[model samples]
Structure formats: structure tokens, C-alpha cells
Target: MDSDMSMHASYAFKHTCWGILLLFLAGGVADCSVVVTVSGPHVAKVGSNVTLNVFITGATRPTIVWAMGDIPVVTWTLGSSSPPDILDPGGVLSIERDGSLSFHNVLLNYSATYTIRVVELGVGSNTSTFTLRVFERPSGDPMCSVTGVNGNQDLQYRCQWAGGTPEAQLSFPVLNATSSGSGDFNLTRKPSQDLNGKEVTCVASHPFLQRNCSVTARGPADFQPLVSSMVDADKKLVITIACASTSLPVATVTWSKGNQILTSGGRYQISSNTTLLFILDFHLNSTELGTYTCNAVNILGNQTNDVSVLGPTVSDLGLFPNQEGTMVTLTWETPRTSVITGFEVQMMGPSLLPSPGGRQRRKRATNEFGTIQEKPSSARSTNISGLDPKATYRFRVIPTAGATRGQPSKELRAGPGGGLSGPAIAGIAAGIPCGILLILIIIALIILCVVWRRKRRQTRYPVSRAVEKVVATQPNLNTPHTLLTGGLKTSAGPPDYSVHLASERSSTLPSVVSPPPVRMATTV
Candidate 1:
């Protein structure tokens, strides 16, 4: 009986110990519902540093595992280092004591979903996940192209940024863009009048690349010059020259006289609008009268215009010999009313006078009748006398003004025998008679034809003429006498009195017999 009681006591004590151990184990397991916290970069650039951390709340120490798509990359234990499970071979990855993964230089191949598992002692495992994306920096510059739009009134520019891991951004004064692969942007605007020669810029911006590009528009292309000279209000000789140019990039205009480039200073003055002008007080040197050039230069090309300063000219000089053969008269007209000093008229004839050096000499006022150098005259005509009767002559005139002498007038050839040679005389004589006879014949034919046409018309449609009859006793006796004319028949009735007599005739009788009405036939 004593042995049985002892055995039963031992069994009950053992059961109580086992029940306590089971309750403790159950409480520990309930405390192990771990809430995991993850913190790290979700995106990283190639060649940049990144860190991913894993933590379990309310746990002093834990075992952690870091993996990429179920493949373990790093593992750690509470009291010692975890087993080596390195996934990156580039020596760029490491793990921290707090269960954090680090990369010194991230690579493109490192991009994947990374999951971290945290386990506390006697606690359950908990997991947190992060997706990492790796990208390379953009490269290269932006390129721009321009084209004309709206009939060249507006310009359309296109800019492109290419060859980047991630696309870059492109921008202009008028537009902007965002792209992931490559960027192409366009802008269009109407250009102002002065917008030629202006610059347009394109800017490209990216995480790792930034650049700018520019271009210049086309410009002016051609030019022309106009030149004139006159005496100014100040009585100073003035010359004005102007240049006009056609260009897109506004042309730069310059002036040059002879071999010297001209600027705005002293006697030279310059001004511009669309037309560029250069004015100078006249200097009568040979160089001053040389060719003046206007040059227009631009990016596209260059153009030039040239003109020479010269004197006034005369025209219409003529000479005619009189019928008496005593003299020849010269006539000329001035082209302009500019200052004229005088005119020099010269004549070379069959009977010529020889000078001392065998060279022709300038004749004085009294030297010879053939050459006449006179003061300016109001009458443009002049007569030359003392010419030998049967000699030929060539006459010309030159106009003089200030210090300039104009070119000689066209030569006029005159001589005896009605101012013509033998052949000219014969032609004139034969032509004049033929012309007059032809005119006379034409007039005679015209008159004869007119008369014949009139006669034919009268015969086709004849008209009647009234006839008057006078009696021998008409002055003493007032009587009515009717005259029958034409081939018409007349019927006389009681005297119809409608005849009117002149007041100058005296009527002795107050009433008299009246004339009868006459009827005429119509002719077709």
C-alpha cells in the first residue's frame, strides 16, 4: 500500500511540470508575430550608391535574408555573420549589422525586385519587398534644323536629343518637351522685319546631359546706285549718291570714291533709310570725278554699283547754208540750264589756215571767221560770214560751264549749192518733184471722184427747184403769175393767196388774184 501511494505522487508531479512548460512555449510563440519595416531606394542610377534595409518591430535581434526574385543575395544572424550568399560579382555589394544591403556602384544588371525576410528568436518569419530600377545618364548634344513656313513669313525649327538611357528634354523660346527615349521638338513663329540676321537657340536638358545649338538666318543679296550733282543753296557744288539693296540678312553698305573709302565726317556726310546716301561738297579734281562705288555686303553674298561724275551736255546742233551762198547759220540747244560760261564753235573748211607748229591753234575773237568763241548769248543761233563760195565745212560746238567743258556736239557738214553734195542734190531734186506731183495727182483724183459721186446721187434722187416769173406790167398792175417747172402736173383751183412780197415794192392795189397751188411728183 505505501509503495503504490509514492508512485502515484511522482507521476502527478511530473505532469504538473510538463503543463507549465507547454504554457510558457505557447506565450513565446504568440509574441513572435513580427511586423517587418523596409526602407531603401526604389530607383537608382548606374554608377551611384544605394542601400536597402530590413527591420522587425519590437525585436532586439533577428535573423535576416535579402534576396532578388527568390535568389538569396545576403543573410545575417543575430550573434554572428550570416552565411556568404553574394549575388553581385563586381565587388559593389555589402551588408550592414542592422540587416541592410548596400551597393557602392550600382549597375544596370542589378535592377530587380529585392525581398527581405526578418525572423526573431522563437518568432515567425516576416517579409518586405522593394522594386529597384537602374538607369544610365543621357549623352550627346541637341541638334536643330530650320525650315521656312507660311511662304517664308514664319520659321519652323525642329530640335532633336538622342542616344540616352532615358530620354532627355528639349526646349526653345516658344516650346518645351519631355521624352523618355529620344526627344524631338518643333516651334514656329512669324518673323519680324528686323528679325533677319537674328539667332535662334535650342536647349536640351537631361539628368546627365545639357546642351545648346544655334543658327543664323540668310540675308541681303543685291544692290543698285544712283548719282547726281548740282549747285546747292549755299552755292557750293554738291554731289549726291545713293544706294538701294535687296537682302534678307540686312546688308552692310559702304561707299568708296576712287581709291578712298568714304565715311561720315568733314565734307563727307552720310545718311540712310532703305536707301543709303553720301553727300559731299564738290572738289573738281580728276580723282573726285572718278568712278564711285557702293558696296553692299551680307552673309549670303555681296553686290556693287558704280557711277562717274561728269559735266552737262548739249544736243541738236545744226547748220544750214542760205540760198545766196553768202554765209552759214548754226543752231544748238542746251540740255540743262546749269551755269554756262560760254560756247566754243569751230569750223574746219577746205581753205584752212596753218599755225606756227603745224598744230591747229585756238582762234581768238578776231582770228578767223570760221571759228567763233563768243560770250553766252540769249539767242542760240549764229551766222558765220567771209566763207569762200565753193568750199566745204565741218562745224561743231562745245559748251563750257564753271571749270568743266562738255563733250563736243555732233558735227554738221555744210557747203555751197543748197548745203548738199552732187548726189544729195540730185536725190533731193528728183524726190521733191515726185512727191509734189504725187500729191497733186492724189488731190485731183479725189476731187474728180467726189464730183462724179455727187452727180450720180443727184441723178438717182433728183430734187426740184422753184422758178420765178416777172411780167412787163408788173410794176403798174398787181397780178399773180405762176410759172410751171419740172415734169410735174399742176391742177389750178380758186386762187390760193399765200405769196409774200418784199416791203420795198409799192403795192398800188390792196387786193389781187392769188397764185394756184402746184403739185410735184416724188422720185425714187
Candidate 2:
């Protein structure tokens, strides 16, 4: 046992002596300084190639090891015949002899803290670390939207770009504004006239991509005006008109007549915002009955609408055909007041054309007014005659007080068959030609029968064939008012003084006809 232990101790002392000798030799080389530097904390986009270069000084035959975080990736030794030993099984990482690291078709997972270690067998060793950040390039163009703010008095514009790493820088070039970090860029302000129809742009900038989006600013739109009339105290008529509009910037409202702009004055009241107008002492014969126009103007454009007031006329005039169809009874209702002296009935129908068969064909002629008939104010119904039973006719009633004629009533139709059913009239018309042909055939047959009978009877029976021809006939069927008023104020934007005549009565007053209120948008 003593001999075995002595042999073991001698072998260990030899190994220890060799270790100390190597250490003394290493210490001599350790005096040389080693320095290593990697290019940077680098940046690269996915699917691209990048290199993290390394610089070394005072190092010889160095062995380099590269790691990502705590995980080993690749190792290379200077002047080694063997290739680098890559820890990565995917083959995405590579190293050069100079201790540099390179990435091929980089991926997002490749982003990490990368360390390069340089070592020389007899010299000092050094390590350098850098961060590699992998980012995705911005995809597609930026998106934008607009919204109303401050009760629609201002507009807010927002722009954004998605699917980019580390956020993208966004800016409104026109406004010279920018947003921080990854948030969207927003701008809000009242729109100006000059901005109307102009394009607003947002640009997004990133390390790997650039994109932009835009929108057009708009002006005034959707303007409408309403007009109404009523009876006020002192038995005077009052008229009210209002206008409204929508615009990026609020629009201005103005009232006008033909070639004239109206302002607040005697008998005329306008709202401060220029949206409402009121007329006092309105009468049927007054000059305040012409067309009144309202205009809404904005920086972008303008829109206008018109309303007219007129005199009273008749209503609901109806026409009824008599049993024989030759006459039509006309009935209508009038306003409660005595504004109308009488009603004039106007008739229009086709003229009769002579036919060889003594039957008449009605020929329609343009502007063919047949006759005008008059009825007293107390009479609500009257009979119109001298109409062709087979022809159609149209009639209208005009309300008249002496020489002044108010607006006319709606037209009514009286028809092709005098009191005949539609099917009966159709059948009669379709059978006329067939009846004529049948008559000729029957006459010929009768003549032949007569001659044959005469031949058989000879002197005993002398037959006289006389055919009486009967033809079946078918029949055919068929303002300005002035108002009296007091003196009114006038301006350069003068309200029209021409009185307009209309047919309907107002809700509160009888015998008052005003222009029907209209809603429309007229672009200027």
C-alpha cells in the first residue's frame, strides 16, 4: 500500500509542475492589452440582412464566441481550418474570422442582446455587447377620418398607420404638425373658405417605410327655406320666412327679391343672424306678394331658395257627366269672402271631321279652346253643353272679380262616352267596321233570295228586293289679383311689390291665397 501511494503522488506532482510552467508562460503574454469593439446597437427590418462588425487590437490567434443574451449562438477561432460551430439549428446566424456577426434574412425573433468575446491563448481576453432590434416596415398607406367638433363649428382630422414596429412618425404637412410615439395625429380647427375644395394630407414616416393619406375640405351644403303667413291683430296679415343651412364653417344667411337685397326696415323685420324675415300688413292686393328669395353663403359656395305669395282663388272644382253624356255639371267651392265676382268655365275638346259614312271622327287640334262660360258668385254649380258625346274634353274654372282674373282651378276631364260604361264604349267602337261589312253581306243575300224566288214563282210571284240600310252610330265624350295695402318701406335690396295670385285659402283667414311654401336647394 505505501508503494502504490508513492507512485500516485509522483504522477500528480509531474502534472502540477507542467501546469505551473504553462501559467508562467501565459503570464508573460498577459502583459499585452486586448481591446474589442462591436459596430453598434444595430437596427434592421425583418427579411433583411445586417452585420454587427467587430474591431480588435493587440490580439493574435484569438478564439471568438458570439451569444444572444445568455444563449450561445456561434464560435470561431482564428486560423482554424474548421467552419464556425453555430449553436442555432436554423442556420440564420453566421460569424466571420474577425469576430463579426452577420444575420441572413433576419427575423423578429433574432432581436436580442448580442455579445462578441475575443480571446488569445497567451494574451488577455475582452468582450463587447450590442443590442439588435428587428422591426417590421410599415404596411400600406396611412388611414384618415374627419369628425365634427364644438357643435359642428370646428372639424377634427385624424390620421394613423398600423402594423409597424416601434411606432411611426406621423405629420400633417399642410398644418406643419406632428405626433409623438405610436399614437395617431389629430388636428382641430374651424374650416375656412379658402380650405374648401382643398386637399389635406397626412404623412407617415418610419425607418423602413413612408406613406400618406388625405381628405378634401368642404363648404356650405343642404340649405332650405320655409315661408308661412298668418293674420295678426288689427286685422293685418303677417308673413314669416326662415332659412337654415349646413357647412364646415357656419354660413351666412341673406334675403332678397329680384335684383334687390332686403334689410330690416319699416314693415319688414329681419333676424340678427339674417335667417328670419317678417312682413307686416300683408294683404291680397298688396305689393308684398311677389317671390322672396333666401340665400345662404359660405366660403366654399352659396345656395338659394324662393317663396312667393299670391291672391285667393277657387278650389276642388269637379265635373260630372249627365245621363245622356252630352252635358257636364261643374261644381266648385269658393273662399268665404267676396273677393271673386264670378267664375269663368273654359272648355277644350277635339274638332269633328266629316266622314264619308256620315259618321264623324274627332281630330285633336293644339290650343283648341271651345268656349268660355260664366256663372254668378252665388252659383256653385253649372251645366256645360254642346260637347261631342264620343269625344273627351278638359275644363278649368278661372275666378274673376270684374276685369281682374285670379288663378285658375285644377283641370277636370269628361270623356269619350256620354254616360256609357268603358266596356260598352270599347265594344261599340270595335263593332262599327264589322257591322258595316255584315250589312253589305246581308243585303246581297236578300237580293239573291228575292231573284231566286221570282224565278221560281214567275208571273205568280214578283218579288221586289228592297234592302233598307241602317247604320249604327257611336257618340264621343268631352290670375292676377291685387291687394290693397298701406305704404311700406323700401331699400336698395327692395322687396318685390308685384302681387302674386294663388288658388288656396290660408288656415286663419278666408279669401286669402298665398304661394305654396317650397323646400329646395339651389347652388350658386
Candidate 3:
């Protein structure tokens, strides 16, 4: 037993000696004098490549060693036969005759605390360490992107990058854009297609990279899709599909209900190709209501719309006419589709075209519950009243489905009052009297002309010879005494003064009288 214990003790001592030797050797390896620094400057960009240059000017190349943190880097020993060099995929280390190291393609991985060691028997060996800091290359500038754009709008471009090897130039002309460093690049282009139907590409030039790279954006194709948002209206599911596609464009349309393979049913009706409208109506009263899935299959791609139906629409439409007013009442069953919680009532006149301004009547009905029309199968009926007399009205019932809430109905015509014949008709019958009055005026004018002609002829007639004889026998004149005073007037007897002075005034003119010497004695 004593021999065994002594042997054990000897073995333990030997192990201790070996451990001590290893510790001393490890410490000697750590003892060295070296210096390391990042090349160019203390700061570098995160993305742009940089080189790490280390200088050991005051020390010999044989005594110096370098490491990245705890990892041992290659060492160059001047006396060794092996080539004094190290190679890292990130960059190659060139050992300069002056004992400096040059590393190219410096990466973020190179960033960290680095230590350099050097030892030459004289002057205690020393280690110099440095920290490599990398800041994120300025969030690689903001880039602009456009998808599914159209001719109505133009493509816009702008760029902003930070932390590049050389600061980016924000003032350069877009037509002659130039980029610096490896970080971010952008382009502004007016992409126009060629007649041969090839995509146009825009190129960006890199000043630092010494090369040009191209980016291609898409433009117009043969088939285009314009899908209308979904809605639940009427008693079924409704969706509108309009295409601005450019080909002879005879497209086959197929609708699907979710993963459940769709089948053509009574409720689906497509408008004539000339009209370009399609409708699917599932007259969902209580029993026939259920959720529906719709898919529009086109050349470009397939669009899917899922809608749920809910109620038994109670629709009431009645017509009434009275002395004063005519009225119509419409009531409908609830809808059986998702998102159709209410209804929109539309009344049209001369068939009111949907507003050209893209407007709907904009009235709505609401449902308090989140109801999914799961196999609804009942009918529902509403009323409209106070319409003008004898007027004709057209009505249509359409179901709302999916996203938008309403659908229009087919047109219906209603005739109110159909009132009595017009009063102006009697006035039209009295026109004969006016014509008779006109004729009477014409006859009166003819009679007046005849009377005027007769009067003019009578005034132009001559008198008889008997009137002339009566005037001749009335008086005679030629006496001188008659020429003075009263005697001058034609008289049968002379004036007294004229009779006394007859002889003296014999030279005066004589007067004449009627009864000249005896018209009565003329019988002799």
C-alpha cells in the first residue's frame, strides 16, 4: 500500500510540471509589439468597400503579429523559409518590406477590435489595438416604384441616399444621371414601347463601379382588366366586369364560387356581346339564400369575389289611381349575400338612365346582424305612393352583392290617372265662326263701292230749259237812275230822288227791273 501511494504522488507532480510549461509558452506567444490602423480615415461607409492598411514603421517584420479580436491572423517571420503572407477571401494581405499589412475589400465583418503584437528581444514587446467602426450605409436612399400604372398619369422619379463612399449628388440632371459608390442608384425615364412590342429599358451609370446596369418596367399589353368592386343587391350576387383590352378581344367569361367548382345555373345571365353586361341573380327569398363565390375568368388572369346572401326580401309593388293622385308601392324580400345588409330603392321615369355623373340614388337600408345568406329561401315585398295622374313609370329590380351595396332592377312601366280629354279641343271646334266673320266683312266692302259710283253720276247730270226761262223773266238792268243808291238795285220803280233829278242825271248808268214795259202786254 505505501508503494502505490508514492507512485500516485509522483504522477500528479509530473502533470503539474507540464501544465506550468504550457502556461509559460502561451504567455510568451502573447508578448509582442505591433500596430494596426484602418486605412484612409477613422470612419468608413457600411456598404462601400474599403481597405484596411496597417503600419509597423518602428518594428521589424519578423517580430510583429496581428489578429482580428481573439482570432489569430497570419505572421511574417523574416528568418523562416515559408513565404511570409496571409490570404482572406474578404481581401488579400500584402506584407510590405517595411512590415505593414494591406487588406482590400474591407467588409462589415472586419469591423471590431483588432490587436497587433511585435517582439524582438530588445525593448519589452507591446500590443496596439484599434476598433473598426462601421455605420450603416445611409439607409440606401429612398427609391420610387410604380406598378400597374396608366396613360392618364406620368411616372415620377426622385432619389435620396446617405453614407456612400463618396456622398451622392442630388443636383445632377436626370437626363445625364451619374452614380457614386456601390450603395444606391436610381433612374428617371419616359418609357415608350416600340412598334415591335418589346419592352423599353432604362439604364443607370455608376461612376465608381465603372459600369452601367439596366432596369426594365412593364407597359401596355394585349389584355387589360378593370374590375369593379363587389356588391350585394336585389336578391342575389352582383358584379360588374369591364375591360379596356386591345385585341379583337372576344374573351370567354367564367364565374366560380370559391374552391367549389362552379356550374351554370338558372340565376346566371350574360348580356349580349354588343351590350357587354353580365348578371347573376339568385332569387333569394328565405329558402333560397346562401353565400356565393364569383370568379371572372379572362385572358389576363382570374379575379375572385366572395359574397354572402342573407334575407327573404319583402317586396311590395301596388298601383292606385284617384281623382287627385296616382301611387305605386314596392316591397322586396331580403337579400342572401355577404355585405348586403340593406337595400336601395330606385324609381325611374321615362326610364331614368343611371346618372351620367356616376351617381346612384344613394339611399340605404341596414341590417343589425352580421348575417350570412346561407341557403335563404323566402320572398319579401314595399310600396311607393303619390304619383302624378296619367303618367307612365318604368321599374326594374336588381340585386346588390359583394362590396358595393346596391344593384338596379329591370324596368317596369306604370300608368297613373290616365286623365280626361284636354279642354283646348273645344276651342279648336269654334274656328268656323271666325271664318264666317271674315266673309261678311268682304260683302260689306263690295256694297260701299257700288253706292259711291251712283252718287258721283247724279252730281254730273244737267238741269232742264224751264229753269233758265224763270231766271230771265225775274229782272232787267240798263237805266242810269238805277246806278245810284237804292235805285241801283234791280227794281220795277225808280227811286224818288232819281225820278226828280231824272233829266239832270241822264248821263248816269240806268238800273233794270223785272216786268220790263209789260211782259204782261207782250200779248200785243
TM-score of each: 0.33, 0.36, 0.26
What local lDDT does model 3 show for residue 177? 39
After superposition, candidate 3 runs with Cα above 4 Å error: 1-47, 78-82, 85-97, 121-124, 134-484, 489-524
lDDT comparison, 2 vs 3, better candidate: 2
lDDT of each: 0.64, 0.70, 0.44
Give the C-alpha miss distance for residue 337 in model 1, angstroms.
Answer: 44
Model 3 residue 284 CA deviation (Å) reads: 21
In terms of TM-score, the best-performing candidate is: 2
Candidate 1 per-residue lDDT, tens place, 91-202, comes to 8878877777888888888888887766565656566788988877655578876666665556666778765656777777533343222478777656554446566678
- Best candidate, lDDT-wise? 2
217-327, model 3: which lDDT tens digit per residue? 343234433323233455345543343333111224444444444444454444454212233553335533444444443222344444454432324343333455465
Model 2 Cα RMSD, Å?
40.1
Better of 1 and 2 by lDDT: 2
Off by over 4 Å in 1: 1-33, 69-71, 89-91, 145-156, 173-181, 186-199, 208-524
lDDT of 2 by residue, 171-197 (tens): 777865444335477787676766776
Quote the lDDT for 212 in model 1: 83
Worst 10 residues of 1 by lDDT: 464-473
